[model samples]
Target: MVNELYRKQLYFPFSHESRLEMLVEKERKRLLKQRIIMHIDMDYFYAQVEERDNPKLKDRPVIVGADPKKGMGRGVVSTCNYLARERGVKSGMPISRAYRLCPEPECVYLRPRIDYYTRESEILMQIIVEETKAMVERPKFEQVSIDELYIDVSSLRSYKRAKELAKLIKRKIKEKRKLTCSIGIGPNKLIAKIASDYQKPDGLTVVKPNDVDRFLVPLDVDALYGVGPKTKMRLNALGIKTVGDLRRFSLDFLKQNFGKFGEDLYLMAKGIDLREVVEGFEIKSIGKQHTFEYDTRDLVEIRKVLLAEAKAIDKELNDFGLAYRTVTITVRFEDFETHTKSKTFALPQTGWSTLLEVGWDLFKEFYYASKKRIRLVGLRASRLVELSQLKVLKNETRRF
Candidate 1:
């Protein structure tokens, strides 16, 4: 009867073997608590790419984005070199504002070359993996973005070797790609990510387990990940300006005020992040959106904007070597009312054609249903799966 009860508790589709595998995986991940995590962040990625391609642009301010047409351009800056940053130019700043800050002959403005940048990113990632593969049995790596990644070298069991590996990766990238990256080593992802930015351009910082508190305490609470402007203001109101100050509050008190996020804040203040370094790249969604200078009811203009966004997202999907099973379209009216519609496919799709076809249909449904002028248009692809993983799954299914 006990055996029957236990067997009945097991859910359908999860065999006894699979259940045992899940338990084994969970135990393995829990053992990673003592992991040695290393984070790599390329310095001024897009702008540096431009500078590398043109030696003459070195030491000069280079801004890569929409043409900053003498303080009258519409789009925002994609990225700017350290020199442009010194002149108060920032990524995501309006091109008009970027021009105002670092105007004319002083700064070189150029549009983004997405394809070239993607190619460079792929080559750099390959170099990192190939250079470090032989050092340990299997160092788990995760690419967070085109220019940022994390590697788990817990198998090495030495911070000294971790730092050495970081230097080797950095040197190899600079040698082969003419690029520089900053690296940070710590006991977990949160500490490593923050340490990566502790120093600029070419930097390597290591914070051992015993030094986690010292490395985190004196810093402002805003230095903790996920503490944005609003959260900082709330923390400041509670007289918690620094991580040291935050340690004075009780975890229960924090949870009472901020709910689930408060627990994260409390843990961060203690420099305690138990999250493991998940291997491989995993993206929930990729999207692009644009707000028009003026709201209009022109379908031709709307389709053009959607098409451009679809093309950009398609390139991103291709760059990541992934495909999507869902397409979603978002439309915001002039009065700030927004609506979204989505379609999911039985099979994953690649290329912009799918987006344009499904997105246009979804938008027209809304356009005809409502009598409001459109202010913004957006396209998003979700339910992403790596193309290689899909092929493997297909092969396994065929064996059945």
Candidate 2:
């Protein structure tokens, strides 16, 4: 009787392995019906760079970001290896908190060397572009941020063919750069992006067109792009906890709750994304920021921080052959309340003195109101125009 009960629990009344085989066969058939897309993401990019250059650091926990200062430091973690992540350390967490979690004396922490990483990334991208014949989009070389990319392989003949191409890209990148990447193949960019993250640190996942529904059904609503904390809370309250639940709602019902974004959410939950990959992308913004260890209202320290950030931004822009038309300053108060002030100049400026002067003025005029202690300060320059365009502007502005 117990054996019978076990079989009942494990298998349906049909009690045939053929039934299970049929299910698998059905899924295999469904997965073959759509366009193939792929998203590629580098794993622990920065930390891996450190390990690559310094072999001794290999096989040890590595954290790459700003100084930890013995658990009394400010700033956030950029990236940490899987080993460190296992200890509850994560990217974007407070470095101090990471220290508290792992507390290993030998845990390696290193400042980001953007130049080195950019060169390494170029090598990786070259290999990918050559192997897949796919368009490559890159952020500015100097920024060294977001070491992830999307490759549209829909033009490829088959999903199996794309998987073979993905394996080659992975092999070349690993052999040349000594780093690993997780790749996901699907019908659209959204599905590809989601599938890529389903695995990590050297993984490959392929989702054929027919498998999209089953693959997405069990995922949480938060998995949809653009759904933040506030949005997730609202979704949960509305009984939309998973993508399957979201699919049940009519477009009109979703729009009623979320406006146009709701419509977008509904479409995404249904695995409908139509974004195309574009190559030769330019940097949208250039900036530097720092979080303080303690919140302070002292203008003196704040100004110092602003100047340092300005200098860093100036150097970064210089390296990238870019210039900024607007200077933005961000202040985060002790309670996590944040505000930003920006000033757009008629001309681009890369000089440290000019950037600091304008940045200070913008902060004084916009951010000096409250007695709230500031826990973080940041400087950003946006509305970027090329340095060559700045030269043309300078010549045009000169009086005849």
Candidate 3:
């Protein structure tokens, strides 16, 4: 009996389930030691809002943007539901083409309701801030155009805490907004942002720091943030397709070819991003532009478009709580040649009326050449400082 007991203890001390449980416990503890970041992305945000308001639009292919005009309209798609995307439609694609793809398409081509969306965004942001103990950060430095957000959940180190917070945020957003959001959890902001996109339309993905390599290795190099079309073509020409292929090249080699952006690409491909989530971010500049399907030299049309563009910029500045000290006008000729002319003001200003007056004045002075057909018009505001930080400039300082 003593010999049999000794053999049992030596050969099968733990059951299979018990061993698996031990492995899971070890992994969970290991993950808890690292900084946990989360990225929350609303699924088809604009379309979802439209759907929520109108129940008849549910489960249907909803396209939000400019009117297709039966495959002859100008402008680009802003957002589309999953059902529309499955039919070979995507954001930024020509609205005309979107109409061509969808069978009996339910297209809603209307101007974006800036005020309504702003209110919704504020409500969702408030919910995130109030519920979670995590440090919330936004991509407002570039533009408040991101439909997604980066949150630092490092305070919630334990897996249990992180999971609970994620669940709560998701539930609250859905309950309050009647919309779905996908969330990604990772060790840093970059990984979390990428992970959130891995699964879409209501996905929740978590990637431990140690597991980042396993997941990122197979993704395309272009999948990394900031790798635009030009960069993607360049990387593809060099036989660098996947993130794994990019990893083969040294950081020095990448920098030599692509300059500073190349170095950033190399680090990002290796899943190494250390960007911090900053709070109370502000915009540096505000601008608006439109591409015309047909080039024309009509001054009346040009002035109309410029006024509308100025109003859009004004709206954006107001949303960001910023004021501009300079106004710029850009014109593109039919041949795709572009030139910009700008004027600086002594006082900070952002009202739509003021911006339009400045824009019209600049256009009249700089746009005397009637020989060339105009293809595009743009308005820009710069030299921005937050309204709260404004300081009056003295008369001597305003001479410039």
Cα lDDT computed for each candidate against the true fold: 0.86, 0.78, 0.74
Clashes of 1: 0
- Cα lDDT tens digits for candidate 1, 336-382: 77899999987688889999899999999989998999978899999
Off by over 4 Å in 3: 1-34, 103-111, 134-146, 291-294, 311-321, 325-373, 388-400
Q: Cα miss at 350, model 2 (Å)? A: 7.8
lDDT of 2 at 301: 90
- Candidate 2: where are CA atoms >4 Å away? 1-35, 53-59, 134-146, 252-260, 314-327, 341-366, 387-400
**Model 3 lDDT at residue 118:** 72
Question: Cα lDDT of model 2 overall?
Answer: 0.78
Clashing pairs in 3: none
Q: What TM-score, over all chains together, does every model reach?
A: 0.75, 0.76, 0.75
Better of 2 and 3 by lDDT: 2
What's the TM for model 2?
A: 0.76
Q: Give per-residue CA lDDT, model 3, range 106-150, as digits (tens).
A: 655555666788788778877876777443332221113446677
Write the number of the candidate with greater TM-score, choosing between 1 and 2.
2
Candidate that would win on TM-score: 2
Cα deviation at 343, candidate 1, in Å, is 10
